[model samples]
Target: MAKVLSLILGGGKGTRLYPLTQSRSKPAVPFGGKFRLVDIPISNCINSGFRQIYILTQFNSASLHTHINTTYKFDNFSKGFIEILAAEQTFEHDSWYEGTADAVRKNFQHYASLEPDYYLILSGDQLYKMDLESFLDEHIKNGADVSIASTPVTRRAANDLGIVKIDETGKIIEFHEKPGPDKDISDLKIPPSQSDGSDKEYLASMGIYIFNASAMEEGLDNKDSDFGKQIIPSMISTKNVHAYTYKGYWEDIGKISDFFDATLNLATPVPQFNLYDEENPIYTKQRDLPPSKINSCTINSSLATEGSIITDSYISNSVIGIRTIIDSGATLDGVYCMGADRYETLAEKEENRRRGIPNIGIGSGSIIKGAIIDKDVRIGSACRIGVDKMDRKDGSYENYHIIDGIIVIPKKTVIPDGTII
Candidate 1:
């Protein structure tokens, strides 16, 4: 059996996912009520038998480190290990990771000790369940130096992702990184023979790759900062680069709008990304909390995770995360309430009242629509958010923000009574 070292790029500043990434790293950001964003790739790696895994993170990694240390613990005899390789200022290199390739290149000294046969590169903020054994098999079967996972996507999505043009033999010929709407990428359309009768016109790189040991070392020999922008394009001409077409559900939860939509979509009867798969389950840090308790609440097409208390509320098309507390007469629609980290004690509630602030969670008679209430927010009674003000400008405010026309309440913010946003 060939040894494959999996490297998950935990992303750069994550400016696109700001506010949420304000206190925590992108990978550490909570998702789908219970699990974090990083859990998707880590679960996929473990399920695919890729035992030795390393996550490369640069910014705001404290929570990520704590979560990893608590959740994934191997037995004393097992060789499997999941570790975080944080960027550090060494004597030789004094700067933080400049880009994706730079992050990996700098960590070469650490991972090189493992001396694996192949390197499996993955993006941290993507949602998908892939059988990487099959991916590695394709790379070995093609006898290619590097294999990039590609998914069929339309022109609208092709603009934001790395577009690849492959020949009939699955050899990648050209690569384009985020060729915006103005670019003429007609030549990059998927070949009819490889289209598999799909309406998607282009094949976009999933930022997932399998590189032979020598090919990776050679590809990173230069000062190329990014894999898609610099290394992959350069290697296509000199190396045996192939494309592995993957026809499955894949979502890049990078932008605020993308994150919001992808999350609420899971509140439906059937989501595009399945979290209830029996065999390939997504893992996370298990909090041994009690079951959610609802009191005469009419919940329709919503996912209320563990340890929530809802009373006389009308929730529709929403995701109420763990440890949530919704007071009586509250109506939540198309909302993603991330829930509190810890339940506020009675003393804490008294302190909040003393400070003239609401307790942690939704107060009575509050109506929130198309909004994201972050963790540990104290929303007072009779508060209306995103319901009345549909055309709110895109900017930050005292307690919340409106980005892409969606209201976002940052972590631990406080909104007083009778407030309307």
Candidate 2:
């Protein structure tokens, strides 16, 4: 295997996921409860046997930096380590990263010094499992100056991405970045041999590229800062740019809706993307906590991480993070809850309220439905959450009932006991 320098782009602001991305960068946002968004790409690289990696980050990078420092570790004796290349001002440039290509261009000198054979560029916010070795092998075999990972998307969806027109031999001919509705796909005129009958046969770039070191250097030096807007197009006429087709489960969780959907999908019985693939294991910082204890709790197809205590709680179809506690008679359905930070706060409050009682007596008789509760929440007994029809029309009421449903409780809220609906 040749020496490959992998660059994972982790700088995007992720504006669409406003509140979630507000605190952390897009790549650092929590995913599947335990893993961060950046973990997918880094894990893919490690699984693909690439060790020399650099993550380029900029906006709201604190959490991202912490994650990288704690999660990724490489042997010092070996020539492999994951490093963060944060945006810095040099003599020539005082501005922040202007675009994707600009970010790589600024860091070009660093990778150049390493003298790697190939430069692998990846976006950190995508959810996919891939063996990059196969892509690199194909690039070498085709003698490609640049190899772009491409996937076929529906015509309706093609307008949102950079679409490529390739020949039978996979040579990319025409490149369109988010083309308009009227632009005929036939005008690009993909060769008859390469054409599939479906009208939605357009190939979309996965924003992943493998470039010959020299080719990347030259392109970055000669073109405008943006890759999608300029460098990629410049290469089409002069370079041997090929498209490597990918047919698998892949999603770009750039928007809040997409992120929500992706997280929920993991709870499916057989999810589209499997993180537990033995052949290509996605690595993360593993916690050595004990298994979740479910005592008289009804759990249905939910992902529960370590150190969780569910007592008489009905949890179903949700992702529960570590160290979460659900006291007796607490019911939850389709709730994504994290219990790390809130445990201490809730414990302190409970202790104060208990005054040295044997039982802390927090979070009892609480019913939660279709909600996302962050860590460290203490719900006192008889709190009706996520239930409909709290009281009967005749003025009679159940002990726990949710009204208007889908209530999201942020971390560290204290619900007092005997709170009726």
Candidate 3:
């Protein structure tokens, strides 16, 4: 087996998924109820047998650090470790990480110390399942200096992605970044033999790269900061960059709308990104909670985690997280209720009742649709949470917000009774 060091890049400020990223990094943002975005990549690496991992982040990385420290623990006898490399002002560089490539370039010394045969670089916010052993094997078999995992995507989605064009021999020859609709990308489309069925599909980079140790050092020698924007494009003309075609479920949850849709997709009957694959289970910080109790609730097409209670409520097409409580007559549709961080005792519930405040979850008779009720939120009875007029624009309200027609109730918020968005 080749010695591979996995580097999971913690994304930028994540302004696109703001408010959710307000307190945590993009990778630290909670997803699928119990898991964070970082969990996806880390779990992938572990399942792929690459245990020596390093997560690199700079902005608001405390929570990300805590999660990594708490969740991924290995035995001392093994040579495997998962650690964080936060950006710092060192003697060599006084500034923060300017780009993705720069972040790795800055940490080259630590990476070199490992004496790795190959370096596997990945984005922390994507959801996918792939075997890196196969990826690495293909790279070695083809004598590739750099190998990228590319997936075939529709033309509409390809415009936002870094498109890669390969010859009949599967050798990448051209790469273009964020080609607009007006740009001619017909030349970038994949061959018919590689296409599963979609004629409009084009090969797009999955932001996953396997680089030979020396090639990585030489590629980062210049001022190029981003792999998509500079290094990969520049390397194609000089280095042995190849493409590995992958046709599987993959999504980059960068925007609020995309995040909302992707989260709900997991609850589907046949999810594109299966979270319940027994062979490759998605790992996360497990919480010891009791089983969920649904008392006469009309539930359909939903996934409620442990320690949740639904007392005669109506839930459809939603993912209710742990420690959630939905009172009688409450309706949840297309909701992602990331349940409370901790359960309030019976005494605390009594105190809230006397104070005329709802408990730590959705109250009775409330109607929530297309909304993301973040962790530890309290919604009063009869509250209507979806868009008041079905508008697809973004807006803000007190303690809540609407982005791309999806309501984002921030963490630890309290929505009063009969409140409509």
Candidate 4:
């Protein structure tokens, strides 16, 4: 196996995921409660036996920097290591990276110094498990100058991505960046005559590419900007560009809806993304905390990490991160709570607000449901939360009452004793 130089692009201004991306970069968004989004690709690289890696970042990358330093560490004796390349200004180039290709172009001299054989370019915001060793082996066997990982996508979804056309020999002949109407799909290469008459519109690039060192260098030098729009299309005519078929669970978390959908999917009974593969473990910073202590709680299909304490609460289908505390008489469904401090503030505010008697009364009859609570919440005894009128119609008032749809209780609000909220 050749020593591959991996460049993970982490510098996207995540405007779609506002508020969450407001504080950190998209790659640094908290995922599965505990891990960050960048952990997926970095861990994939480590598990795939490729240790020489560099992460490139631009916007609000402090959290991303801290995560990489705290989570991934390599021995000095080993050749395997990870480096973070933040944007720097030089006399010739004083501006931040404009596009994917420009980011690489700026770092070309740095990469050239390393003397690597192949360059593996990857996006940091995608979610999937890939063994690059297999992809690289296929690239070598095909004698391809550039090999891109591709998957079958529906025609409707193809418009969002750079669509490619490949011929019978598995050679990519044309590349279209977000095709427009009247663009001939037929001219877009398809395999030889198929058994079915249906249009064989298969194989869209996964935005993952393996480039020969020389090809990458040439493309970086020739193109002014934009890898997908300019450089890739230019190389298609001259180089042996090929598509490597990939069949796996992959997603591009580009927007808030996409991020939300991906997070919610992890709560399923049998999630599509498996993080428990011991052979290819998703490594993260290990917080030294005790296992979650659940006492008399009704929890169903939820993921609770270390240092969680759930007592007399009803929780279902949620991801609870480290050091979270769910008090007795609380009900939660479909929520993602990260960190303890934020949870505590919300709990206190709700406890005080529900009492109506201000600081002197307890919220004994409160109920809560379908809400995300952050850490360190101090709830008064007997608060009613998330309980519905229908639940009370049966003459059973054991559950807390729900106030409205999507109400979040900030952490650390105080409540008095013996009040029905």
Candidate 5:
């Protein structure tokens, strides 16, 4: 077996995700109910027998560092390990990562020392379950210097992605990045024979790639900052790059609207992305919290994690996370309550009450709909979140702001009594 190093790109500031990425990197952003976005890639690597993994990120990585430290503790006898490579001022490089390719270029020295046969590069913010060993096997079979993981996508979706054209032999011969709708990209559409039964018109790069170690080193020697924008285009003619088709659920939750929709989808009876597949389950920090307690709460199509207490609440189409406490008469719809880091002690709860402060979770009679309540948030009584339902984007209102018509309450914020968004 060839030793492969899996490099996950924990994307930059995640400006599109805004307030959610306000305090954490895109990979560190919470997903589903309990797990962070980083967990998806890490779990996939572990399941695929790729343990020598490295996450590269530069912006707001404090929470990412903490999560990795506290969660991924490898046994002394095991060779499997995951590590973080944050961008720093090294002797060779002074500035931060300009783009994906530049980030890998700066961190090359670290992974190169491992002398892996192949490099498996992945995006950190996508939601998917993949057997990476299969990807590696295809790369070996094709004898490709670079093999990109691709998925069939509709023309509409392909317009926003890096599209590819593969020949009958599955060798990628052409590449186009985010081709404008006005431009003609008929040459980049998937060949009829390879289209199989899928209605998709084009093969879109899933942002996953397998690179021969030497090829990667040579590819990054240029001043190009991004892979899709520069490196891949430059490699198409010189390198034997191939495309491996993937048929599964894959979503890049980069924008706030995408994140919001993806979160709420988990509340459905059968989500597009399943989180309960025991064979390839998503891994995360497992706190020993008791199972959720429902006190006459009416919940429909919702997922409540362990250590939650819902009392007389009507929760529908929501994802309730760990250690979440929803008081009586709270009506929750399309809400994502990312639970607290830890439950406040009795003493701490008493002190808050004495100081007339709201408890560490949702309070009584609160109507929370189309909202995301981040960790350790204190929602006072009768708070009407997403109450305004305005489509216009505006400045923050008491830290409870609207992004693309969804109410986003930043992490650790306090929503006072009778507050309305």
Candidate 6:
């Protein structure tokens, strides 16, 4: 087998996700109730036999570093390892990661010792399951200098992504980055044969690439900082760049709305992104918590993780994360309640009661809908959030925020009694 190294690019300050990204980097944001966003690509790489990996991170990387340290540990027998290459101001490069390609360029010194034959670059904030060994195999078989995994996306979504035009032989002939609706990209639409006879569908780069080491060295020689915007387009003329069409479920969770919808979809009976595949399980920190205990509660199409206590609540189409606690008479719909980090002790609960504050979970008679209640939030009794009003404006409130019409309760927030959002 050929030597290959994987680099997962933890994105820039994830302002799009906002409050969720307030404390942690985008890759460290919790996903599927339990796993973090970075777990997706790491799990994919592990499943695809790419054991040697390095994750590049810059802003708000403390939680990301901690997660990577505790969760992914390889045995002492093999050459398999996963490490973080956090951006640092060294004597040579004195600035942070300016862009995607720049991140790898800055960390070239660390990669040189590995002397990999090929480099697989992936995005840290996407939801997808791919057999990367097969992807690398195809690249080697085609003898291409670069291979980009492209998925067919609708014209509406094409505006926000890097769209490409490929010839019949799958060689990328043209590439456009974030061409807005005003631009005429009809010429870039994929042919009927390539798109399964679909109309107005174009191939969008998934931000997944395989590069020959020499090609990568040459491509990153200049100061072009981003792959989609500058490097790939420039390489199409000088190097052999081809497109590998992937017809699978893939979603980029960049915005609060996307995160909201994607998290809730996991509660569906048949989610587009399957989390129950035994062959390719998404790995994360394994917690030794007891099974969830539900008493007189009604849950429909919901997923509740370990160490949760639900009493007489109504939950529908929601994902209740680990260590969550729902009080009696609480109702939740279309909500992703990121469970607490630790259960409140008896003394702490008593202290909270003495202080007249709500405990570390949903209080009695609270009704929350169409919202994302982040980790360690405390909602007092009779609180109504995202249920009664649709006229809420998009801005930061005293306790929560409304972004893209979705109510976001940031991590460790406290919503008092009779509160309504």
Clash totals in order: 0, 4, 0, 47, 0, 0
TM-score of each: 0.98, 0.86, 0.96, 0.82, 0.96, 0.99
User: Alpha carbon lDDT of residue 260, candidate 3?
Assistant: 90
In the range 287-322, model 4's lDDT, one tens digit per residue, is: 777878888978888888877777777778777777
Name every residue pair that clashes in candidate 1: none
lDDT of 6 by residue, 1-421 (tens): 7999999999599999999999999999998889999999999999999999999999999999999999999999879999999998999979889999999999999989889999999999999999999899889888899999999988889989999999878889999999988999989988766768765489999999999999999999999899999999999998889998888899999799999899999999999999999999999998889999999999999999989999999999999999999999999999999999999999999999899889999999999998999999999999999888468999998989999998999999989989988
Q: What is the clash tally of candidate 4?
A: 47
Task: Measure candidate 4: CA RMSD.
Answer: 6.8
Q: Identify the runs in model 6 with alpha carbons over 4 angstroms from their true place.
A: none
- What lDDT score belongs to each candidate, Candidate 1 first? 0.93, 0.78, 0.89, 0.73, 0.90, 0.93
TM-score: the better of candidates 4 and 5: 5
Q: What tens digits encode model 3's per-residue C-alpha lDDT throughout 1-421? A: 6999999999599998988988889999888888999999998899989999999999888899999999999999878999999998889999899999999999987768889999999999998999888898999999999999999888888879999998877889999999977898887888776666865579989999999999999999998889998999999999889999887788988699999999999889998889888999899997888999999989888899999989999999999998898999999999999998888899998999899887899989998889988888989989987835655458777788888878899988888778776
Alpha carbon deviation, residue 93, candidate 4 (Å): 1.0
What is the total number of backbone clashes in candidate 3?
0
Candidate 6 lowest-lDDT run of ten: 191-200
Candidate 2, residues 263-355: lDDT per residue as tens digits? 767988999889678988777776777888878878888888777877887777788777777788777667777566323556766776676
- The weakest ten consecutive residues by lDDT in model 3 span 387-396
Model 4 regions more than 4 Å off: 180-200, 341-421
Residue 183, candidate 5: Cα error in Å is 1.8
Worst ten in a row by lDDT for model 2: 394-403
